[model samples]
Target: MEVRHKQATIDKLTHENATLKRLKFAAGREHFNAEQRRLLEDTLDADLQAVAWWC
Candidate 1:
């Protein structure tokens, strides 16, 4: 039982680490120029604000 619990914990942590790595890769700015990145950020900010306001 103890071994199963530890293995479960390790598996969960490994999955979380892999998810974080994928998110980090996707969020990297290397694919965008500065202007494009700025535009995307501005659009995202506006969308977030709209969501907040709706909420």
Candidate 2:
């Protein structure tokens, strides 16, 4: 893959990882409703699909 493409992908994945982590932490603290937690987990798993190797 092209370096630019890879870099961009990595950057996007990093941003998403940060967002999901924040969501997970907030959810763990009971900030998210049950439905919200389910959605967050699903989205987080989907986001991880972009960089499964890194994980």
The candidate scoring highest on lDDT is 2
The local distance difference test score of each candidate is 0.63, 0.76
lDDT of 2 at 33: 72
Q: Which pairs clash (backbone N, Cα, C closer than 3 Å) in model 1?
A: none
lDDT against true structure, model 1: 0.63
In Å, residue 51's CA in model 1 sits off its true spot by 30
What is the C-alpha lDDT profile of model 1 across 1-55, one tens digit per residue? Answer: 8788677666655665575466469776446668976886686566556544543
Question: Can you list the residue pairs that collide in candidate 2?
Answer: none
TM-scores across all candidates? 0.49, 0.64
List candidate 2 segments past 4 Å from native.
24-30, 53-55
